[model samples]
Target chain A: MSNSTAFSRARFAALIACFAATSPALAQPSTVGFDQISAGDTAWMLSSTALVLLMTIPGLALFYAGMVRKKNVLGTALQSFAITALITVLWVVVGYSLAFTPGSAFIGSLDRFLLEGMVYLKSSSQLSVSHIAPTIPESVFVMFQLTFAIITPALITGAFAERMRFGSMMVFMALWSLLVYVPVAHWVWEPGGWLAAMGALDFAGGTVVHINAGAAGLVCAWMLGPRSNFGKDAFLPYNLALTLTGASLLWVGWFGFNAGSAVAADGRAGMAMLVTQVAAATAALVWMAVEWLTRSRVTLLGACSGAVAGLVAITPASGFVNVVGALSIGLAAGLFCFWGATGLKRLLRADDSLDVFGIHGIGGLVGAILTGVFADKAIGGVDSHLGVQALGAFATLIYSGVVSFLILLLIRSTMGLRVTPDQERGGVDLALHSEQII
Target chain B: MVHDDKFPIAAQLFIRLKRSPGRVIDVTWMLENELYALEVLKVARGADAESAELAARYETLLRNRKPGATAAPQQPTAFARTSSFMAEPEPVPAEVGRHYVGSLR
Candidate 1:
């Protein structure tokens, strides 16, 4: 290894050591004498888990597949499905521990690696650990949240689709999940997390998931550069029908994603679901109306995209905002995201292939800001933690952007980010798998 | 919310109205302008007026010859044109535009 490589490795090792040292010294809590769980909560969680999984497998996969050039459709879908499998396994092995174990403000140590002490069925409350859905078992909760973790990085892949090598992407994702996503998740969601301590109220990962993914996606697209025919060619989706269906699935699945964050069959979950639906509906209408006025054609693709943008915008604030707040947020997200995807992106000339930064980044930013404005104490039942929410959002945006850029640089230096021109022309499926449609 | 199938129709209508070959039309203006026009039309006629009134108003606007008034309907600008012969079955080059992908087959 070079001197810099050796130094980086040494520094990483030392940081891991420091993390280990600072972990709480408490022994694993015994799982004896816990009361039986409610069937309604159990059913809700199970269905929510399925919905979240659907968001990745068919929902996100198809959405991205339809957006890419026809030659790369199967490749894009395969990557999304593979991420679902990979993240599930990783969550079971160490991802859960890194994100949820009782530790410092930044990240959790490996005390629960491979799910050591979580084999026994017990609620998070009974374990008397950090507060994160005390009603659900830690393992169940990890599995549910793993679906979110899986999709967030997969979403970024859309930004660099048709150009990235499969091997390089896999390596980047593995490292990114470990170094970036887990730490951010811990910071926002874990009971003793620094952001949580500072009173940041992220009901469903506005900062940790959407903003983090969006900023990182922007960096990845910048580092990877535009595709071969980016500016010169008129690149368009091959299948608007597929895109619409995927967007519909995402709209439905998001209710589970946002509401299930509450971890109980409660009124808050109902309100979150309601707001999610209203926002999606409003956003779809707004986007269609805008497109009809501007382009004189209300394409299905625009409406689907608008619905998703609204869904993303409402994720963080779904649990906090009332119906009126949801409507305003949704309408704003639809209009602003449409502008970002078309006007701003065209101005910047960055090939964020499928508008990841526009829809998710801009949408997430809008949600974070609106959360500050509409966080009613009577609705969400939490004090207006607007300042802390702003701080968390700003911190996540800066950290994820800089670190994601550095990681992309490191990966690019080690193993090139893009495929050869011939490989890209031939298609990633053929290039990576040595198979074509025939 | 309208489904995706309605998008093309809505967009076509929007483009038709925007570039209606009328005087000084720029389709690239924001949606707010379209809403403003709709509001103005609604106020000019009654809100309960049918589609005939709207069509009459559109025709009048298109044919008006006052100084600085909108011009008569003319051939579409290059940008307003779609690839020709898209609904046709053949792969003929001239039938479609020069850049049309049908020629590739």
Candidate 2:
């Protein structure tokens, strides 16, 4: 038997080999075979994929549905569901290849086009695994990342909720997913990504998901313009109960989102789960307190939004931060997101209908920057620079914003981005989808 | 409060009425009397040439409303008659202004 010191040296050598194997090439099929894949990690990843997917379908769907007027509830909810279907198909086709496979630092190669090289040959007992996650089957890793892809663009639908044409929305999201979402996912998550090379520490997509979606959401809000009589109308939500339920679902599903980023069922993943809970709970309480202090009453919406804000803010830091870091991040997320949704919303005057930019955008920024400040190297096994984090966050924001604007502009000039005023007056459910709550 | 089915029109009228410089308009009444509400909305939205005068006339009638008054003889209310600012016959009658105020509790 080997001595303890020799065992340690061997483990270090194995770690180096694993790191070397992950170095970006064409994601070079797989030297890691089926037997090598960890069953535990694969099981967790499969469950996490399902959990993350849940965050989009009924979770985001109901969250958005409850916020819209009675006439628009169906249309609003449909956006999330539709994006889920759309991105699922798109991710399988070319999106996965262009995002994950290594090529240029700016974008990925198409070696895995149509998931071509990904194989599961039971006869030979050989299966493919992604270089990024050699411990799990590539199929599970692909599915896990696909959930992230689905939710990112779906998040933007909240900004232009009551106004967009369904066909135009579908078109815009498809294009935005390809043009804006794909490259940014490559830039941040893919090992060959420019941001990754710059030592940006995004444990779970602070820049890639939240900032990217937030910027696109802001642009959508601006381009779609405000809902009719936006500033002057009450715009009461259809049902707070549904919103609360959806928020609860989101809160539960976020464990998969943050913890699953660890790609392993280890101590790190456990720490991520703990911090996520701490941050979300802290932020929820802080938001209600602020609302109670300022408005003399706490609102369910404020609490839910605060919880989501905390979740968003802590996402990038979840794999990197400790409990104290989570508390600070949660506190800042609550206070800043409240102001973002109210004061900054009024100041921006973009009519981001559902406060997407206010909460997700501002929350993402706070989280991304704070990750640099609070990242514990002991936990993450990496140190992060504040300037590098800001660079990654801002770069994603600008890239997503500009590309989204161009895509909207193109769609607008061709098919028109909004329904006519008459159609809008009739409610999108009846006018757009020919369905209503009755 | 407006019914869900009629909320779209009610919301439009509410916004238009709120923006127009005047006393608070009874959105519930306007929703109940939708056709006349559209006319009021057109004036409130400044779509009419004499919107200012029309709005003032409407506000005066709304202000003088007497709740719980049964329908009376077809007597012209103060706002129904024309003044220097008006040419067309206004729709305001005493009964039109007398909308019910339901219990809040």
Candidate 3:
């Protein structure tokens, strides 16, 4: 480790020590004293949880589904909806324990496994609270984090959209959530984890959610190969209107995603919400301007895509940066992500079907690095180093990329990864699900 | 008549359209029709190679313009033709007038 890394670790250790000494109740992992709970924090967190979940099912589902070809619309939407259910179950089982609880420097313990220690005693008005969010009930925190878990894998589906077998996708996602997502979440969010110890500032999952999914998505696209007639024929989006609606919902719900990360109903959360809006709007306009300049005519799809790019890029910086930082991050995200989707995409020669890597992966990276540069110490109450931020972002990318590829390879050897060519041509909606839109 | 046995996909599409004769034809209808039409033609070409050759020739002919249609003197640029302009190269490419006109297929 470098000198900066060591300094970061020392600083983080001091902060932890200070917090532990000052508030023993907050540092303890097992149970929260009922008196320590904040009803206002709990209420906001509950609302935030619901809002974040909205970003997945109807939000991401519609967003992805609108972009796929009509034949695969239902199947594509089903991926998001199904992953929502799948990750919810997995998070409750062991994923929450592995990600959020205290353990070794790399992974969390099984103390919360099957929610073993979590308690809700209505008669005594007692409930469990995570060390991570001492003010809010642990149940609320789990649900909020579960929403994040659901969206990450759901985001990956965009890369291999309209190709993978449904059963194989389910299996691949299940393994990926455990092996890739859980570990990365622990590394970045859990205080004892290496990245956190190194003072990586991912206020709202730039490394954990966006970059992680982006890398995995690129791998899935490479492994699955291109959709049939990919370059030969125009694979136009089915409906831009649905896409706009989804993007709109994602915009609104991101308040919960970023602000909710604060784990409190406080000024920091308010700042996060404000910065998120500024970044998203700036990125959207920049993207539209770039598209108008390059492609000549501005399209609704391009506008929607630009807005999403902005949102993805602003995610990690929302809490740490002010409006000025948000604008700069959004601008950078728009320009870089446009190239990623177009020029970089062609250069990589991978058929990332819906530009998942282009937008999410690239946007996540830009946000993560810029967060280091633009993070206001006064606002965030912590100084961030650029090197540490880059380390966390690139580390997650490489780790997720390699692990996702291995998982895909394992699945390929066993049950196979893609639908048969005939089934694909006939449309997975009918072939796999036995349903199709007229 | 397109037979169901010969061109099942096209035949099915035709039946659907026929059943809804009052349906408003739109871009989606054209797009789907074009897709199924190509599928039928692909099968036909597989059975006999001349169909492919004829289709290629027809595509070329459709793209080619009438001889000497642009023989009349014209302005050098769109701005020169539409309004007034200084003699300078425009930074942006024109949206139309490519030598090779490719179809959506």
Candidate 4:
């Protein structure tokens, strides 16, 4: 061979070696099939994990904390904080297995118990990819889905705030997550699952997260009864400024909630991002306009709630609808959720503190039904299918509602659900947690 | 010990002691809580050497240690208290009046 050809060959080999050294997987020919996975997609999902987790911690915590009365501020915030820790542990142990692993149609198996087979420590290591989220590693998918699981139960805490026994509340959440959330998640998101086979399209958990949690919240509100004063007193929010800050974070983080569901950094993700902003803006304005008409003044609280309502409504349709479809859904969510919070609230006679049922329940229903109506095949959906959407929403509502009530009933009979009236009157911060805002 | 005429208030306390000695001790503690210790001692001094003898002895020592004006009577009606500026005030909570302080150095 010529000396010039030898020199060229050596340079080519050096370039190839440098590229391989960039990532841990690239350093060795591992057993896990790491070749087919998209680096951009994996990176985006990892970032999405952080963003979704952010929604629960400071975002939901502050949003709830600011709305509660002064004495219960710390108590309320700590519930979200506690759930984040608790749910993460549960997800690590078995939640990931039961929700994402291949098993029966309604629920998954414990095949990945304690997250086995997720890491590749040897040269022959092959990464586990969820058939549903095939482009990303199973661990990344697990972390992403775990964030959803954490926030769903955390959302339920808003219903029974300032009144439930701390021990009982903890127990209730653990049971409810395993029994209600896991099955619904498996049915809807898993490919071989019943709802997914039934052609139900829940892009980012409109039915599972919002409707399921919302229905459970309604049951809890009824079972736990109302805050002591209920209808007789005016319970004002403690701090709207804190609420505003939290709402802003939730708004930003929700792009991860919806757009991240695309599981890719592609055109679909781009459209999801654009539609999310549109719906939020539209719903915020419509809510303000209607609120101004009914009440004398528009409020910051009104705008924030409207924005959230829009976000919830757009969730199921984020990947399926166009700009026009998104606007229509947002407008409907604002109008419906406002009434759900006020008129339907009075009608139900349920306290539903923080309006979880009103916003998430009503918003989820509106979005799910509308996902059926607005999902144009030209955009990115299967043929428009309202019947399928309604079926999915109805099933989630019934299952979560009944199971949550039964769980609460069992807990109520055993450990008791509420604190003593004296403890409540003094404030749950000091009563339940021995903590006071001051 | 049953001289109701010489010491009417003390005689009343003795009568209460007759019904329940435990209750009388509890009443003394209540009086100690609601009235000045020295003031309670002064009133107890004239009482008969009856069942509240232990209470009376404790009051007498408290009286000698900090002699002051007699305490107001415990009654159904609201009692007005003197506002003493000389006593130390409690330290305010950090969260309280925080906005007023504005940017600590």
Q: Pick the candidate with the highest lDDT.
A: 2
Return the lDDT, model 4, position A145. 94
TM-scores for all predictions: 0.75, 0.78, 0.79, 0.76
What does candidate 1's lDDT look like per residue over A1-438, in tens digits? Answer: 596576557545544554555664434323432454455765788789889889888999998888776668888888888887777788889998888876886888787788787645335434322246555555567778898899888888888888998888888888888878899998888765677655677888778888898888888888999887566444555566778778888888897899888788889999999999999999989999998898677867788888988998898898899999999999999999898788777776678888888888888888887888888788788765455568888899999889888888898999989999878766787577543332
Ranking by lDDT: 2, 3, 4, 1
User: Which parts of model 4 are misplaced by more than 4 Å?
Assistant: A1-31, B1-105
Considering TM-score, which of the candidate structures 2 and 3 is the better prediction for this target?
3
DockQ of 3: 0.02
For candidate 2, what is the DockQ-based docking class? Answer: incorrect
* lDDT (tens digit, per residue) of candidate 2 on A38-140: 9899888898899999999899999889987677999999999999999999999999999988877777888889999898988888888887898988899
The TM-score, computed over Cα atoms with residue i paired to residue i, of candidate 1 is 0.75
Q: What is candidate 2's TM-score against the reference?
A: 0.78
- Residue B104 in model 3: shift from native, Å? 14
lDDT of 3 by residue, B19-39 (tens): 433211122222234333344
| Better model by TM-score: candidate 1 vs candidate 3 | 3
Worst 10 residues of 3 chain A by lDDT: A18-27
Clashing residue pairs, candidate 3? none
Q: How far out, in Å, is residue A426 in model 2?
A: 1.2
Worst 10 residues of 1 chain A by lDDT: A25-34
State the lDDT at A184 in candidate 1: 91
